[model samples]
Structure formats: structure tokens, C-alpha cells
Target: MIKSEIKKLPGSQIEISVSVSWDEWEKYIELAAKDYSKEIKIQGFRAGKAPRDMVEKKVGTGALMDAAAQRVVQGTYPKVVTEQKIDAIGKPQAEIVKLAEGNDLEYKVVTSVIPEAKLKPWKKEIAKVNKEYEKKTAEVTKEEVEKEIEEIAKSRVQHVDVEREAQDGDNVILDFEVKKDGVPIENGTSKNHPMILGRGVFIPGFEEQVVGMKAGEIKDFELTFPKDYHAKNLAGIACLFTVTLNKVQERKTPDVSDEFARSLGKFKDLEDMRKNVTEGMEEEKKHELKEKRRGALIDALVENLEVEIPHVLVHEELHKMIGEFEMQLQGMNITFEQYLIQIKKTVDEIEKEWEPQAIKRVKAALALEELAKEQEIEIPAEEVEAEMNKALAQYKQIKDIEKNIDLARLYNYVKGMMQNEKVLEMMENVK
Candidate 1:
């Protein structure tokens, strides 16, 4: 006979225990050996043809036993959850609780799950938000556009001139090589490389060393690398750079005029440019105001609705954010594991740090979701259809996603979310 139990743990975690007799463990060993047999490469035997006893002797009872425990726990976990009516969301962390040769195999699985929190109603507050928004202006004026046009024209023309010494914020052209303990790091020399002064794009103190150096001058600076520097070989070590300043130039802005305005390509005149600028600025301001107000509304609703978040959802969001950050690192040619190493942080440590922010995000999402429910607020079917058609029309030329997606559901979800956000914004403005 086998006994299984789940223990509720602190921090919204649970521990599941499964204890089975030695005979049952042996049965699992036989089952698992078959599944993993083909992949085992054994000398003097064709793969998958080795007898279970022979395999056990070759890989040892420990290997087979471990595999058996894995199979037993994984196979039983879902059943336990179903039987208990437990709604688990993420992967459980499994550990061996009891194990001995010729005895029962026992293991425990621990994991974070969701919390049960209720949401509250926010409609009465929504009206005050809307009234405040209605009182405020969402406008685009001609004067604002004219000022933008003038600024754009003025910025279009830049004055460049040779300078004797590289000043702060001046653009520097140089050939630089950085080394720590006499070892080269990343492209030792670059010829006429465009370097922005004071950007800290180079090793710490590199730009400061270049400061006041004239064209055709050489300088060397020593600095300590950041304690947690990304380069493994350079972290917390002193480094030096041999830099040869090739040239220096100062940047200057120009005055706005009709010719500067026409540089923007086919602007009939300053007046026409100014008018277009004003209209665009007004539209942008309105969009920003709409978003700002919407955020306020959601915060109010979350507090008003009194949301209780699921722990599983918070971890899921944290994982998602971590994934996004890792993707950005990927584009720069480094994996998240590599980044973690650079920061000197273990994955668990970083995850723990992210939990608080993740919880907040989860709470906010649930609160808005609940408000949507309490109000019976929804995007009309017609609105969903229109949004879908609009999206497809906008991305008609894109392949794969645009062609294969279920436009209706995606549009409805997006529309529902947008409506909820707007409603929150309206609430904020009212009071």
C-alpha cells in the first residue's frame, strides 16, 4: 500500500509526500528501465537489447532507483492533485524524503501556488473619475504645433568644427585598447572610432582620462573595474587603456527658418509644417492623458475591489519578466545564465528579489479583471468584430501571425482590457 499527503507551507507553498513500499519501487524500476533502455549505450550490447538485470548491473541500482523514484513521483503527482482537487499552476520542486535499499521509497514535492483573494465593486467611483476627466481638457492647439515645427527645424542643422581639446559632451574620435593585468579585452584597437564623451560607454574613468586631451594626443588612465563587472576576467580588477585621440569636434544647433523647415522634405512652408506639428502634438497629448488617467483608475479599483492574488500568478509574471530581460540579453549575444553570473546572483536569489514586484503586478491585473466582472462590463460583439477587421487590415501584408491567428478572441480580449483600463482612467478623473 502507498500513502500520499500534501502539506501547506508558508509563502503560499505546498509540500506533497508520496511513500511507497519497496515492492512498488521495484515495479517502477522495471517500468522506467524500459522507457530509458533504448537511450543507454552499453559496451558489448546493442542499445535497447540489454536485459534489465544487465542494465541494472552496468548503470548500478542507484541510477535505476533514481529514475524509478522520478517516474513514481511524476506519475502520482497529477493524480494526487486531481483526487484532492488541488489547482496547481507551476512546476513543483521534488526532493527525496526517504530512501533505503530494499525499503520503501518516499519523496516530497514543494512549490508555490495561488492565493484566494476577493475583488470589490468600483462603478460608483468610476463616475467621479469620468466627471474629473470631462472637466479637464484634452486638446491640440495651433501654437503648440508651431513651436514643435520651429524646434524640429532648428535641430535639423548642426554645426561641426575641429576642436583643439576634447571637452565634456564633445564627440571624440579615437583608437583605444583596454587591458587588465596586461591582458587584452574586446578589440584592443579601433581606428577613428566615434566616441561620445562622458557617456561611460567605455571602462570606468576612460572618458575622464580623454577629457582635455587635444587632437593627436595620447593618454593612459588606470581604474578599477566594477565589483560585479560583466567580464569574468576583469571583475574587481584594475585596468588601463592606451588611447590616442584622432580628432575632436564641437556640436552647435542652428536657428529655425523656412529653408531648415523645407529640409524635412516637401513641407510647403513653415505655416504648413507648424499646422501638421500642432495636430500631431495634440493627438499625442490626448493619448498620453488617456493612459495616465487609466492607470489612476486601475489603482483605485484594485484598492476598492480588494483583490486577493494567486501566488502562482505572481511567480508566473516574474518568470515572464525574467524571460523578456533574457531575450534582450540574447540580442546582445549573452544568455540569462551568463547575465546572472556577471551579476554574481544565483537564479533563486534573483527570483526572490523579483517576487514583490511580481505580486504587485498580479494584484493589479486581478483587481482590474474582477472589476470587469462586477460591472458586467464588456466590449460589444460588433466592437470586437470591428477591432479584428481593423487589426487584420493594418497588418495584412505580414505573414504567419496575421494569417493564422483567431482574430476574434484576440481582439475581444484586447478590447476588454482596453475598456477596463479606460474605465479606470475615467474613475480617476471623476474624483
Candidate 2:
């Protein structure tokens, strides 16, 4: 049997003073002796075959007691936390206060836990937000549908080789190099780079200079970068560019017609295409508005919430945010280290900058969790299992999926998500 005294500490931490009875301590000591005996060799016996008493004599009572204390603490700390209903976050810091040969084992464990949250009248706030947004409607105009069609038509455009001088809206391929004060600028040299004239992709006057240039023609010109250019070093600086025009192609965009609509799979005619595009736009707008309203509701709730967020939770959140940021950088074909170098900031600096947002996220999550409890919202085990099975089926092509994924942790995460969705839906229906 074990005895423990729990004391609440500052910063959402709990300190537990644990004492294990001598009888239990003795059992652990014997088990520890047996484990140590596995490595101890006796003169007349095979390796790890020595008796516990013999092993204790060889390794000494102090080592045996220490090992036993570790075992007892490791075994009891989790049970104490669970039985006490402590919502611990990170690893506990344990310190053995006493580990003697015959007396009881004593230890102290300090762990960070989820903090208590005091939420405002979130339902009333949510209802007000819903009522305000209820007056607005998502609508797609004819011009918006036409714009979508234009983009689709542009995707199907063809570029035909032309021997004439480059003109506005014509695709041009060129080789160019830029120099600042007779010294070449970094990343300013390109070969066979494609650019569409009048796109204003380059510096203001650079495209204009390429406008009248024909294939095989080379020209040298100087242009000044905009004062507000993103690269401060080059901003407002005049640079010389040596350009060689290699090719020009006229862009041919198809007109919006029934034939054009049919060419794009699964459309009966131009009118049908327009109808589908308008519907899609309307649905997208509705989703965007819904998201905006949800965000507003969450923001309102978080603003009124009172909770002392533990540092461990914030640290974990920061780690997650950094991982998400790294994924975003990867999507842009950029590495995290490269991004840091380009931005001239360290990871620590970035985390410090993002700390406020992380805190807001933590508060929002805590508020939602508290609200769920207040509302008595619970997720069914069957629903969680069904969702998990569905998710697993989607990944069936990956062999040994269980080996790669922690199914229990995944189940908890999915359950939490479903509960949050249910709670949010409840709030959304307040009006």
C-alpha cells in the first residue's frame, strides 16, 4: 500500500509527497535484486543465476535501495496521478526523499497539469454573433462567374511560335543578367526565362524594354528598382540589365462558347458551365462566411475566458506551431533553415514572436473544452470506433499501418475533434 499527500503548486503544477510501506518497499528491493542478479556473476554459478541474497551482498544495500526506490516511484506515480484525476501534461519531476534499507520509501513528484478555465456566457455571445451574421447572405455575381470562366479559358490557352517583335500579352523567352555598379547582382542571371509581356513581372521598365525586341536581338538597359521593393538592399537602386531575346510566342485564348465548354470534360454547354461555376462560387462563399463567423465566436469566447495556461502546454503548442510552419515552408519548396536565414531570425525569435498567437490558441481550446464539460457533451465510443475504422480503411494501401500510427492516441484525438465539432454546432444553432 502507498500513501500520498497532494499539494497544488503555482503555475498549474501539483506536488505529491508519496510514501511506500516497508513491506511493499521490501518486495521492490527483492525484485530489484533479481534484476541486478541478471548481470552479476558468481564464481560457482552461470551468469545472472546468482541468488538475490548473494547479489545484494555483491552490489551493496545502498544500490539495491536506490533501485527499489526508483521502481516504487515509477510504478506508483502514474497510479497516484490517475487515481487523483490529475490531468497531467508533461513528464513529472521526481525526487527521492528517503531510500533506506528497512524504512519506508519516500519521494516527491511535481507535474504540470491542465489548468482550470473560467469561461464567460459563451452561448449568449455566440447567439449574438450568429444573429448578426444571419442577416448576410452568400451570393455570386455574373461578373464573378465570368471571371472564373476567363481563368479556366486561360488555362487552356495555346502559345504559337512567332517571328515578329514581342508585343503585350505575347509570351517571350529571354536570357538576361543584371549588374549593380558594374558588379553582377546575386540571383540576377537567367537563361531562357519565360515571361509574358505586359505582365509587369519584372521591374517597371524591364518588360517595356523587351516589348520591341525581336529574336536574336540583344540590348542593354538600366532600370531602378521601386523604392518600396521587398529587398531593401536593391530598393531605389539603378541596375544595368543585359538581355538577349530568344523566342516569342503569341498566346491564343479560346472564346467562351458552347464548343469551348464541351472541350472541358463534363459540361453540356456554356450555360451549364456558367451555372456550375456560379454554384461553386456561392458554396465557397458560404463556407468562407461560416468559417469567419466561427472564428468570431471563438475569438469572443477566448477574450472573456480566464485561465492560467501552464508553460508546458504553451511549449508543446509552440512546438506544434513550429512543425506546422515547417510544413508550410516545405510546401513552398523551402527548408526551415533556409527560411530562417532569409528572414534573418532564429527559431527562438520566431517562437517568441508567435507566443501570443499560441497562447490565444491554447485559451480557445481550453474554453471550448470547458464549455463542452458545462454542456455535458460526450462522444460515443461507437462513433469514435466508426470514425477510426473509416480513417484506417482510407490508409489500407499502406502496409503495417498499425506499426506507424498509435491507434489509441489517434482514437483520443479523433474523439476530441468530434466532441469539439458537436459543441461548436450546438453553439451555432443558438439562434
Candidate 3:
């Protein structure tokens, strides 16, 4: 027989004390001894074929008792949780309280459980937001269309080498290196980099210094980084730059006309091109507006949600956010360690700063889950499978797709996504 006691702890955690009878302990001891026989050497006996007495004598009473306690705890914790109807999250932390040869086993297990989410009235809030969004139109102004057209024309601009000093609106190719206090800065050297003058793409004074330089001209100047520069180490610091102008090219932007449209190989005329651009801008604006509305909906839901979020969930979310941040840094060709050095902050400090956001994200997810439950929204298995298959297809070109992907985890993620979508759609379409 097994005896147990359960206590609810703060922060959505539960503690369970379980005691197993001596008979049960003895059974596990025998099993443990049998397991040890395969690994423990005994004279005149084949591996795993030694008798229990010899196995126990060889492995010692203490080792056998420890192994038995482990087995007993592992075999009993799940049964206790299931019998008690505990909705545990993450892993249970186990601690042995009592273990001895020929005696009962006792252990304590602490685990986090799902918290109760008491949600406020959110349907009306979502309906109001949806109504507000419905009243607003995603309209693209003529100026916006013209601006996009100008950008397209600029993309097709021709650059012709000219033997003249670099000027505003002229493309300049240059080699440059920046140094602070006579020491070269990392990632501050470039060769044959091309930039158009008057773009303000470089430092405040750097572009002006290049404006008068002709091809083959080497000029040295000093500039101060902006006080609010993204790299904290270089912010508000003076740096010396040595720039060698290699080439100057005058830029000629094409006129937006029927000929330009024909050259694009898709539009029939300038009017057709304008129409497509306008439509594209409109679609983009609509998407932006839709995203804003979705954000507002989630914000409203989170505002009305009341739940004690588990620290474990927030910790998990923080690590997920960190992973995403690391990926973004990688995209910029910066290592995470280098980013930390540039920002002058430790990972712990960064995570502390992101804690509130992590908590908010957790609350928002809980709110969505509550809404789904209230609405009885469920994602079909077939839909989850289809989405999983679609996701898998994207990575099918990679070798060993099955080994690389956790299919069970991917399925759960897809199902959660589908469920959230269904719930959000219901809220959006609430009459």
C-alpha cells in the first residue's frame, strides 16, 4: 500500500509527500539488484545471470537502496499525480525524505500546475474594437503612391562614371576606416563601399566631408557619433575617418512613362503600373491595419484577464525571447556576446528588462486560451495534421527531416495556433 499527502503552494505550485510500504520497497530493491547484476561483477556468475543475493552483496546495501528509492519515486510520482488529478506543468522536482534497506520509502515532489484564469468580459470589448476598425479604411494617398513610384524609378537609376568632385545626388565609391583614439575600431573598415551623397546614410559630418572629394582623393576627417547611437560603446564618441574616394558617378533616374513601364516587362503602360502600385499599397496598408486591430484585440483581452502566471512559464518565455533576439543579432552578422558587449549589459540584466514583456505575453496567451475555452473552440486533428505537413514540407529539403524536427511538439504548436486563430476570428466576427 502507498500513503500520500498533498499541499497547495503559492505561485501555482503543489507539493506531494508519498510513502511506499516496505513490501513495495522490497520489490523495487529486488528489481534494482537484478538491474545492477548486469553491471556489477560477481565471481563465478555470468553478467545479469547472478543470483539476487550475490548481486546485492556485490553492489552493497546502500547502492541497492538508492537505486530502489529512485525506481520507487519514478514509478509512484506519476500515479500520485494522476490519481490526485493534478494538472502539472513543466517537470516535478523530487526529493527523497527517507530511504533505507528493508524499510519504507518516502519522498516529496513539487511541481507547478496550471493557474486559474478569471477573464473579464472581453467579447464586447473585441466587438467594439472590430467596429472601430470597420469604420476606418486603409486608404493610400496619391502622395504615397507617388513616393513609391519615385522609389521604383530610383531603383532603376543609371550610374555613369564622371571625372568630377563628388556632389549631392551623386553615387560615390570609397574606401574608409574609422579609428577612435588612434586605435582602429572593429567592423569600422570597408573597401569600395558605394553611397550616394546627401543621403545622410553616414555619420553627420562624414558625408559632408566626402562631398568635395574627387576620384583618387584621400581625405582624413573627424566626426562625433550621435549621442543616441545604437552601439552604446561608440555613442557620443569622436572618431577619425580616413576615406579614399575611388569613383564618382552621376545618377540618372528614369522618367515614369510608358517606356519605363514596358521595360519592367509586366505592366502594359504607365497607368497599369500605377494601378498595380496603388493596389499593392492598399493591400499593404490593409495588412498593417489588420495587424493593429489584432494587437488591439489582444491588448484588450489581456487588460481584462486576471491570472497568477507561473514563474516557470515566464522563464520559458524569457528564454524564447532571448533565442529570437540571438537570431536577430545573427542576421545582423553580430554575435550575441558581441551584442552584449556593445550594449554594455549582461544576459541577466537583459532578461530582467524583458521580464515585464514576458509576463505580458504569458497573460495574453492565457487570455486567448480562456477565450477559446469560453467559446468551446477546438482545432480539428486533420487541420493540425495538414498544417504540420505544410510546415514539414518547408523543411523537406533538409536531410533527416524526421530527426531534426520534433513532430509531437510541432503538432501541438500548430494546434495551438489554429485554436488561437479560431478564437480570434470568432471574437472578430462577434455581432
Candidate 4:
């Protein structure tokens, strides 16, 4: 028979004491000895073929009981938790209280429990933020719209052959070589390279000297690299560049008229294009404003939460955020280890730096979940299915993920997302 005693501790913690009868302990000891026999050697006997009495004599009853007690704890913990109905959060910490040949095997487990979340009047705070946002205006200026139009026109420009001398804003094709102290530098020679003057595509003063040079003209110039140039050897050093201007091409831009707008497709005229651009800009501004409002609401919600968040929850969130950061680094063709070296920090230091933010994020999540529960917010089955399908479609590009999808876990994730969205919508409507 097994027995347990449960006690509630301060700060949403619980202590459970579990005791196993002597008969039960003896049974586990025999089982553990049998398991240990498989790896023990005895003279004149094959492995695992030693007599039980000889095996006990070889490994000692104390060592055998110790291993048996470990197994007993592992096997009995779940039954105690389910019988006692303890909502444990993270892993349970165990300490042996009594383990001997004849005494009942006893151990104590200390664990964190999920605390009941208490939230303040977050809706009122959200309303205050929303009212402030309503009074502020986001507008797109006329110059901004005109700049977009100009960029579109510039993108459509064509390079044409010209007989005049090279000028600023003209595309020049040239062959060039750079030398330092009359020694040819590595990776400093190119043939028929196309450069646009006044674009600063070359080193400062390099392209400026090319201006006014006609076709088939060769010119030589010297310029000093910046003190903070990326290559340490060339920093602040003067280098000579020999250039040959093969040809000059002038940019021919299309007229900003109805014909040009029609060529862009879907626009009837310049006015129509301008109208659509203005509308698009307005929509973008609205999205920015919405994001700002959402941020404000989350901040307010985090401030209103009054609960003791589990340390394990915050630690898990920190690790998750770090994983996300690593993924972003990978996307940029960089490794997390490389990033750590470049930033001159250890992983522990990075985790310490992110601790406060992780705590805030965990608190915000708990508060949202509590608020949703209090408000009786529920997601429909059809909506969850649709969201799961949409997510599956997005990830269908991965070769094997679609075939091995975890439908239950995906549905739960989608349901959680839908509930969060509904909660945010409620906060947005608080007036």
C-alpha cells in the first residue's frame, strides 16, 4: 500500500510527502537487483546468470535499496499527484526523508502550482489609450505622394547612347584599376563596369573626376580612404585609380501622363494613380495606428496584472525568445554563436539581459488568459479548423511537414490564437 500527505505552502507552492509500505519497498528492491544483475559480472557465471543471493551479496543491499527507492519515487509520484489533484506547473523537486531496509520508503516533493490570476480593470485603461489615439492624426503629405510618383518614373528610365561628354546623372561604362604605392591592389580591377555619376557608387572623388570626360577618354586620379574603412589595411591610405571611359549613356524618363499610367496597368490616368497611392498610404497609416494601439493595450494589461507568475514560465519564455532571435540570425546567414562573438557577450549574459522582458511577456500572457476566461470569450470549432487549415497551407512549402502534422496540437494553437485576437478586439472596442 502507498500513502501521501499534502500541504499548501506560501507563494502558490505545494509540498507532498509520499510513503511506501515495507512490502512494496522489498518488491522494488528485488526488481532493481534483477535489473542491476544484467550489467554485473560474477565468477563462474555469465552476465545476468548470477544467483539472486550472490548478486545481492556482490552489489550490497544498501545500493540495491537506493536504486529501488529511486524507481519507487518515479513510479509513485504521478499516482499521488492525480489522487491529490495538485495542479503542478514545472518539474517537482524531490528530497528523500527515509529509505532503509525495514522502514517505509518516504520522500517529499516541492513543486509550483498554477496560481489563480487576478487582473485589475484593464478595459478602463485600454479605453484611456484608445481615446488618446483617437485625438491624434496620421496624415500622408503631398510631397510624400509626389516622391513616390517620381520614384516610379525613375524606375522606368532607359539608358540611351549619347555623343556628348560625360555629365552628372549619366551612366558611364568604364575599365578601372586601383594601385597603392604603384603596386596593383588585390580585387581592385574591373573591365566595362557601369557606374552612374553623382551616385557615389565609387569612392569619393573617383566618379567626380570622370565627369566631363568624353568617350574613349582615360583619366587618372588619387583619393584617400576613410579612417573608419572596413578594411584596416586601406583605411586612411591614398590610392591611385586609372580609368577608361568606354561610353556615356543618358537616362530617358517617360512623361508623367495618362499613357504612362495606362502602361502601369489598372490605372486610368495620372489622377487615378495618385488617388490609389493616397488611399494605399492612408491604409498603411491606419495599420500603423492600429499597431500602436495594440501595443498600448498590452502595456496597460501587463501593468494591471496582480499575480505571482511562475519562475519556470518566465524561464521558458526567455528560451523561446532566444530561439526566435537565433532564427532571425539564421535568416540573415549568421549563426547565433557568431553573433555572440561579435557582440562580446556570453549566453548567460544575454539571458540575464532578456529576463525582465521575459517576465513582462509571461505576465501579459497570463493576464490575457484570465481576462478571456472572465469575459467568457470562446472560439468556434469551425473558426479553429479554418485557422488550422490556413496555417497548414502556409507551411505546405516545407517538404515533409504537411504529411506529419500534429492535428490536435495545431488545433489547440489555432484556438489559442483566435481567442487572443478576440480579446484584443474587445479591448479595442472599450470606449
Q: Judged by lDDT relative to the true structure, which candidate is superior, 1 or 2? A: 2
lDDT of 3 by residue, 66-124 (tens): 88889999888888888988888988899999987667789999999988898987778
What's the lDDT for residue 354 in model 1? 89
Ten residues in sequence with the least summed lDDT for candidate 2 = 40-49
Q: Tens digit of lDDT per residue, candidate 4, span 1-431?
A: 78999887877788999999888777777678778888888888887777767888998877877788888998889989899888888888998899987779899999988776888777788889989998977688989888888889989999998999999999989999999999988888999999989999766788789999999999998999877654668889999999999999999988888898889997999999999988888889989999898888888988888888778777788889999999999999999998886576899999999999998888778888898999999998998988777777787464477568787887887898889899999998899
Off by over 4 Å in 1: 1-30, 33-73, 79-86, 93-113, 140-169, 177-188, 196-243, 305-312, 326-354, 372-431
Q: Compared with the true structure, what per-residue lDDT tens digits does model 1 show for residues 45-136?
A: 77677778878887788888788888888777777778767767677888987767679888888866665456655666666666666666
- Please rank every candidate by TM-score, starting with the best: 3, 2, 4, 1
Model 4 alpha-carbon drift over 4 Å, by segment: 8-12, 23-26, 42-52, 136-139, 148-269, 380-386, 393-408
Q: Which candidate is the best by TM-score?
A: 3
- Assess each prediction's global lDDT (C-alpha) against the native: 0.74, 0.89, 0.89, 0.86
Ranking according to lDDT, highest score first? 2, 3, 4, 1
| Cα distance off (Å), candidate 3, residue 384 | 1.6
TM-score to true structure, per model: 0.65, 0.78, 0.81, 0.71
Q: What does candidate 3 score on TM? A: 0.81
Cα error, candidate 2, residue 74 (Å): 2.1
Per-residue error (Å), model 3, residue 163: 1.1
Clashing pairs in 2: none
